[model samples]
Target: MKNAKSMSRHRVAIIAGLLLLPGFAFAQQSITVTSWGGAIAAAQQKAMQDPFTAKTGIKVIPEDYDGGLAEIQSQVKTGNVKWDVVNVEAFDALKGCDEGLFEKIGFSKLPPGDDGVPASKDFAKGLMSECGVPTDLYANVLAYDKAKFGANGPKTINDFFDLGKYPGKRALRKAPGVALEWALMADGVAPADLYKTLATPAGLDRAFKKLDTIKPQLVWWTAGAQPPQLLASGEVVMTSVYNGRIYDANVKDKRNFAIVWDGQVQIPEGWVVLKNGKKTAAALDFVRFATGTQPLAAQANIIPYAPPRTSALNNVTGATKSSLPNAGQSGRAVVSNAEFWSDNGDDINKRFSAWLAK
Candidate 1:
């Protein structure tokens, strides 16, 4: 009887020892994620990092890359990729995927879908995969000072070109995506036909010719934050500006800026997993957690950005309602075609740069 009892105890000890082997222990290491540094990073730390660390007992280290894409490209070329997870712009993600700098996502391990967010997926999923999961969906809307436009506000993109009718200092992004689209729209090309026309020589010429009309009125802006400042200081009465900046100026500062959603050019931010990451599984797990409905909604609420998950949108509370784009409007707002931007972004940017220089 004594010998049999001793043998049972010895077997249990051996099993426990095997479970604590070096290989198994090493699998629990923490992961590092890289992302664009700014206000978004603060929101991520609050919504994702703290909660994930508490739940999993794994440390999450967040690093910022000021020039995110350039850093990633440098890492890839040098063959010393340090990023395990990254937040990339939609266009950058597409470019990275094409270059094989990203790993294929595995969707089977993610949480169940809530509202519009996919149930499972990890790798290069946008913040909100449905409604085009936008990390940040900012409209390059026509923002005008209520004081300037007053009772006769510019209602559409057409008004942007009618400077003769509503004259004031005007600003526009010096970049191509929205600027080109706006230029073509001002040329009387329909939104649906804008891209197609730009693809043809005549359409390109037409857009350039139309732009020439307003060129003198234009104050070219390079950064997203510049336009709102231009408006708030009364340097410009009307300009194409990011919706968030306009909202902040209007709501927080009590400025009279307003956004015209018609023909708004939406830009989406995206996320991706790095290729050859050391903690691939853990990094994917983080992605799933960060993009989960509650976390996504929470971040959106705090940051004035849209949650990517459909379920996340449902979780958005009353406090967040006032800040979201088209919050009071009927039906879902129009989102920019990420695939289109991803495909033509480089060529457009180059052309726009040349035009700006001219």
Candidate 2:
């Protein structure tokens, strides 16, 4: 369960081709960076993308897309990959690398972070990978309207399922990613045993059964911007959201939203070079600059997600760090398993899709 005070998280999704890294001429050549087109992308632009361009005198173009693999796969398959660098979810990064859709990045190319921690050692566990370099450490958290629930709001993941007590419509992402894990968690699965339980047919059925309880009252969102809007307009009293969206709303918009980090599922997003792109050199350079200690840390100051590099935490404002999903006071948190999702996602995706169709 998540409160409305702060929200930041990314889920696994998306892909694309590689080419030679071309030289940049300050105002001439540019590499298009693709990411979700919400506050998430805005924060990245403010913290990394724009600054990177300013610092290197390289032009950077931003683009948006729903978190899907079809586009990227098509680009790579057709050998017309347009994106020099792609920001993808962790599981997609793993799947892409496994399918040879991404360039195999090695640790040697990554320099030590500003804090002096080696890139290989600096990133949080499960972040350093073969294809993608971890860029953001986020948590899919629950946020609620304070006025609706008053002082006694839904405080735990279990409470999200207790419709009788909460008495309101709920919002969650339409995809299967963390929705299944949350269902199992609310049904009493321990954090440590979540994947193991979900791996079993009985466990899978149990999760779906739990989700069935909230099906009629559920409102699903397809974009990161929708969750906060749902709560703001009171269409849904409570909704699952990225930690940064709620954080920005609470800080900038002055909304009475609370974020409950309990049962928050942590996810790390990464930037990868498309093997079919023409700018392998420039793409790798951008990835390194963006994921470096200073840039990664700077991104957190503008948003609520924790930085992947431990060193970057030092740069985040106290207010931001305190509300992170992994903070000690934020309650129990679990990292999403990239390998499990990468391997079984296709099958589970179909099942989730079928259930939604029904």
Candidate 3:
């Protein structure tokens, strides 16, 4: 009777070990991913999160935030990081990585594209970083309500600054990044020489002087979702917006917003795994899956942001293509220089705040 009892106990222990294996234990794992919410969150849920859960049995808990590094900084400084993976702008990705606030991702671990090409070759050049991998290219472009603009609406990038021609209150994000670039371009700085000129005192003065022309008419917006709302309510005639938000407003909400792609500032956005998260393994797994070619392409169909992977772009189809920032006049679109921002952001942001106070 003692021998039989021992054998049964041994068998029960083996069964428990098997149950704890990855395949069976995956359902118990969950990771939190933070993003700029609304349409982007909804798109992520449909394209990546849901499918990832189904395939790996790992749950993704989504959270929303207005863009910034303060929350991440607080979490990391206190050793209480709650976000496992975060959707970061290119500048933050570089900045956070420099500050050692994020995990150093092993790009080699990412799988090959669905087309069988290696990930290194499949993704766009300069998009993959040591700590983050870009999922898509989003643009801050000019958008206007079609009904307000009528048939002969604001056409050129310069028109966004032409109060007499387009004539009404205009909206721009309160940040200096894209707004400064737009101001420089409107002041006749060439797209290729924008950052170069903006680095100079005279150039900074020129850009600000241009902005001053519209200062009284400028309505400042701080959130990604505000541009569309500002336009829809006739609060502003034209506003600089994330292309995805304008797309969602028009397609999903049946609003008549139109995007002016000329001089659009394209920025790479992607996932960064926070350092010291409890769910590091699950977070890395989800990043690999979500940034894959198919998932990126799947997201593009829902939101207008173009996938950073060539393979993913090839896979994207449907009406969303027309609204893609890269699909328009290529010469006019400016890919933001992340390095420049990483180096100069603090100084410029302080100056911008001073200008805002004035």
Q: State the C-alpha lDDT per candidate.
A: 0.69, 0.83, 0.90
Candidate 2, residues 89-185, lDDT tens digits: the string is 8999999898888998867888787868887788777687899888887888889989887888878888889988887899999988889889998
Winner on lDDT (1 vs 3): 3
lDDT of 1 by residue, 1-358 (tens): 9999999999999978976885444345677876554456766778887888777756878888643366777776777878777876666666677777776653554675554445643222443332112345545678888887687898878788887787877888766667778877766677677767877878777787888888888898765567778987888878987676776566567887877777676666755777766777777777778767777777777666666556776777846566666465322134555666667777767776787788
Error of 2 at 112 (Å): 0.8
User: Number of the top candidate by TM-score?
Assistant: 3
Q: Judged by TM-score relative to the true structure, which candidate is superior, 1 or 3?
A: 3
Error of 2 at 248 (Å): 1.0
Clashing pairs in 1: 113-119, 115-311, 116-310, 116-311, 117-310, 128-133, 128-308
Window of ten residues with lowest summed lDDT in model 2: 10-19
The residue pairs found clashing in candidate 3 are: none
Quick one: ranking by TM-score, best first? 3, 2, 1
Candidate no. 2 TM-score: 0.91
Model 3 segments beyond 4 Å from truth?
1-15
Model 3: how far residue 346 lies from native, Å: 0.8
lDDT of 3 by residue, 167-267 (tens): 88999998998999999888878899999998999988888898999999999998888999999899999999998998888877999998888889999
Question: Each candidate: RMSD to true structure?
Answer: 6.7, 12.6, 2.6
Top lDDT model: 3
